[model samples]
Target: MNSSMFNKSNATSSIGENIYHYLRKGIIELKLKPGDSLSAKNIAEQLEVSRSPVRDSIIKLGKEGLVDIVAQSGTTVSKIDLDRVAEEQFIRFSLEEKVMMLFIEKSSSREISKLEELMEMQKANLEKKEYNTFLNYDDEFHSVFFETANKQMSWELIVSMSGHYRRLRLITLWDLEIAEDVMKQHYDLLKFIKEKNIDMARKTVQEHTMRIFAQKDFMVKKYPTFFKEKNDEIDLFNNFKR
Candidate 1:
């Protein structure tokens, strides 16, 4: 962990929350990669805080499956579990589809204009090859649906459950073609929203939300260590003649 990444001057809030956010960002950004060891004492020294807060932050991350604490082996960043990623993706798709339905029914001209502005920003970011910034715009664009539908808390919950998925997205964002395709999908969704075409909007949203699954084989091949592979037991009786 880089000490410079931690802002020590934010003296108004809990030290544990500050450390948690710092470490969480590092993990999500792939700076502190899977299986990387984390030392509470070292982190405390770096952040100029007590080990107590660092320990607390690690515990919180452990709850989120972003950190793993072993009795004999110490603490390390957890590997991205594909099952967890799939679960979060399912939850997001389900909830966001509902939110989009509500948004299509409730959105006003002003909200549509705001989305257009965000789309412009996304295009600008893409032109600049600022993929991270583009992703922020992408998030904000979807967030408008939840916000307009009065589901900001639901959006937050989805975000909270999407750490592994976000990390995977960060990896995929390196591909310009994939990034451009995502932008195009965003535009299509926005067009459907403007036309109040509910069925088309739902279809676009479903395809957009589930597009990441198409990248699974490539992602797993490229980052074998980051992803988990399933090992299911074969049923001998099922394969045998009775």
Candidate 2:
């Protein structure tokens, strides 16, 4: 809608940018599964765009850790990197706790009402088995705290850097049991916020953010190909000789 976002001078509307978003969504939504081939030529043909743009898009996705570009085997959607997921979880838990606590001090009834609306939307999504839409609201629910606290940029930083973590979240939500737990945690957070209970709010933030790890095993087992194995931890090429 703005100059920087839509201007053709910076090539923001270039075929490459379009392709990047298209591929990025597929990766995040699990429409393009991990290890699925990413044929730039094929995509270029499908979208009626030049191969150059498709290649450019692939490179951009690679930088985001959403696509893997191997030396000889060609590119694919990267598997969920659990190590990165854990790191992201830690970053989110620490940062959001501070943000939510800040919100409790400064947020008004209006902001609280906004959060309540999002919760209702999430509930409707859950009832309809719209897991993807639920996750979108889940993101907005957390973002409200950051935005209220004047930390919108901080939330953007987390989201822009959380490709691996985001995909796993969608996969985890396939089990409505986990979705219910997540929803309860959101309500608990709301309760604490309304009460101006900083201590309880902080505790709920921790539980809410760290719940992903609690469900790690379930996620990995349920979607085996979706994640990299623990054995990947040993990068022996750097540690030993053949």
Candidate 3:
């Protein structure tokens, strides 16, 4: 291919990636709040790309439950479903607890060293007040454990549920004291896992997931507009009390 054609192809690929990552990050961070309207044309214009790539990105986001396309109205950010989130949390907890147990059994001292390094990074991020960076390292710490255990699907499940917990984490990041407590729990968990204590690791994983789910009320009240209207189906969130 000619140099001009190669450059054009490269630019198109770059635009596609930019559009995808822009929307994905917004959804993951809850910046594109639930039920927020989305427009391919507007997104394309804003990103300086063609509508086709924008449309493709929207479709991809939909599969991830980050966006919704109404038949007649338009595309919109997805409303938070408390029940679904709970279900995902349950599944993730069950899977990851097992993975954590396996990790405790199989991990080496070198792997523990890697985890400690990640924890140190998280601590540094916390000191710097870089909440997002802390999150990245926190994820890395957990992911390394799962990867060491060869639990790819479990890791994927954890990664998937991250978006569900992202908004809550964003809220929690504001409280330095609470963040410190969380960091301490992570440290304890790491120590127990490194000691090859399966029971402690499982309990720690369960406790962590439950703690996250306990924030449901705070999220729902703080962002009432982020939920969908109740249909004929039962609304468990309706009975949720802080």
Candidate 4:
């Protein structure tokens, strides 16, 4: 923990952050498996906190697409759906490709080096089979490019949508071949950005995103239970919207 993180105020140590980190990590590491029922009372008791904090944390998780709230059934860890994953990837790829191209055009050598350092950390975490660590570092690695856009709102939107499909990304991380491919793509993208190759950087980012999308069918087949059931009647009705 750093001093900046530890500095306490009214907001500090609030039940929200405590509960949020607990569930966020659980979901990220698959500790709380998909469709597992969330017990607010149990969690609050375990952490020696009140249910209010846990409830707030649950709402945060819901916003991140990690929890499902049902009026009659209570809250459960969210199940992944292929269509939602595809939709999120499309949005992410749309923004990030442009961000990568912009970064390649405008970044200094210092910024490229920062990304390289994060990639190195990601590689080490992967070698150690630390999937969560690798995911965090990998996010940092990508954020370098996004931050260059100077569009903070876009970055937040990207991360929120990306969190929706985080479980799929976890699956990709488990396959060593896919992990190696990701690392290689990271290196390639970094090299292009450093060399001011905007076209190559943009293409590389698109290819990287598409590679994951290509694995969608495989993932869906292997993890059929991951997706939620779609309400096709509602979709059909929505299609007739004014």
Candidate 5:
């Protein structure tokens, strides 16, 4: 795995904090991948850091549900938890739908054109086959809605809770068909916004953001081990929640 992403400096954070950030980014961005092994010794050697900070970061990541550390065994990146994904997606859909509707109601054509520019930039990255940059633009496009709607706090909350969902989205976006479909939906979202059609905007958000649930079967079947499977315990807990 290319562990070089951590090299980008954050001067204030401690060595352990930096390791935690690097490992978390790798896990979330699919560089390390679900179920990929991580050794503190190897990581320390690779990073030219001591094992103490490396181990500390792994423990911190484990607490955040991004990694699993087993005594006498090893640490591995955690698989995507669909239950958490579903819950977080619902949270995202609720907030983002309202954000989009608000943006449409209040935004000028000039603001809408700015969104178009972002889409064009995303498209350029896709054409260049740089999916990571494409995903970054995708984030900027959506963030503009929250920023414009004055819901930056809600955006931060959604991001804080969306580690699993983001990982799955990264995996999903790698498919050309799916990526193109997502881009088209983005365009349709802009159309609804330009028309100031709240109903259609709601529909688009529901369809576009919630499409992941529909694709769950495809995702699980293709990458079985990367997703957490449902089981009796899970069903029992869900039933209990009701």
Candidate 6:
């Protein structure tokens, strides 16, 4: 792993939070591979901080299911749990569909214009092969509906629960075709929303949100070490019930 990736010049945040963000970003970007060992002491030495902050960050990451801490053993980046990803996908799709319904009812032309601007940005990023930046624009496009509908807190909650899904998405960014397809989906969804076609918008959102599942087999085969074996008989709804 490149320790320099963790190095940052900002000093506004607490050391623990800074370490947490660094490790989280590395994990999401696949710099810290699944099952890779994480040495708190070594990271502390590299960051020129005491182990306390690193340990705190590790514990926080553990709570997020991003890392596993074994007693008398060492910490390792957690394998991508497909079950968690599916659960999060479901939650996000359901909530966002509801938010889109509300947005369609109340959205003004100005808000629609904002989404169009984001779509243009996504197109530009795609043309430049800036997949990461394109993903950021994609996120912002969806977020506009939530922000306009006064659901920013709900958006935050969904994002907090979407770590695994987001990491999986980051891996998929290498597929330029998928990026292009997603941009088209964004455009179609935006069109539906602008037309006040709530049903079409909801369907579009559902299809777009669940489309990643189609690549499950390919992703697992390509990155075998990053995924854990999930029981075929497991009931996703039951397992993820609150």
What C-alpha lDDT values do all the predictions have? Answer: 0.83, 0.83, 0.74, 0.76, 0.82, 0.84
Q: Candidate 1 residues 54-118, lDDT tens each?
A: 99999999999898899988999988776677777778888999999899888999999999999
> Each prediction's TM-score against the native?
0.89, 0.89, 0.82, 0.84, 0.86, 0.89
Candidate 3 local accuracy as lDDT?
A: 0.74
Per-model clash counts, in order, read: 0, 0, 0, 0, 0, 0
* Alpha carbon deviation, residue 211, candidate 4 (Å): 1.5
Candidate 4 segments exceeding 4 Å error: 1-13, 229-242
TM-score of 5: 0.86
Candidate 4, residues 14-133, lDDT tens digits: the string is 546856876887876788878889988887777666788788899888877789988888999998765666667777788887787677666887887798789889989999999888
Deviation of model 4 at 71, angstroms: 2.9
Off by over 4 Å in 1: 1-9, 232-242
Per-residue lDDT tens digits of candidate 6, residues 1-242?
A: 34444445555666677788888878876889899999998989988778988999999999999999999998999999988888788889889989998899989999989998999998998899877677778888889989999999999998778888887887776788877788878888988987889999999998798778777667888988998778851366344433
Candidate 1: residue pairs that collide: none
Off by over 4 Å in 2: 1-12, 232-242
Model 5 lDDT, residue 8, Cα = 42
What stretches of model 6 exceed 4 Å from their correct place?
A: 1-10, 233-242
Candidate 5, superposed: residue stretches over 4 Å from native? 1-12, 232-242
Tell me the deviation in Å of residue 232 in model 3: 10
For candidate 1, which ten residues in a row score worst on lDDT?
233-242
TM-score of 2: 0.89
Which run of 10 residues does model 4 get worst, by summed lDDT? 233-242
Candidate 3 wrong stretches, greater than 4 Å: 1-18, 229-242
Model with the higher TM-score, candidate 2 or 3: 2
- Cα deviation at 156, candidate 3, in Å, is 2.4
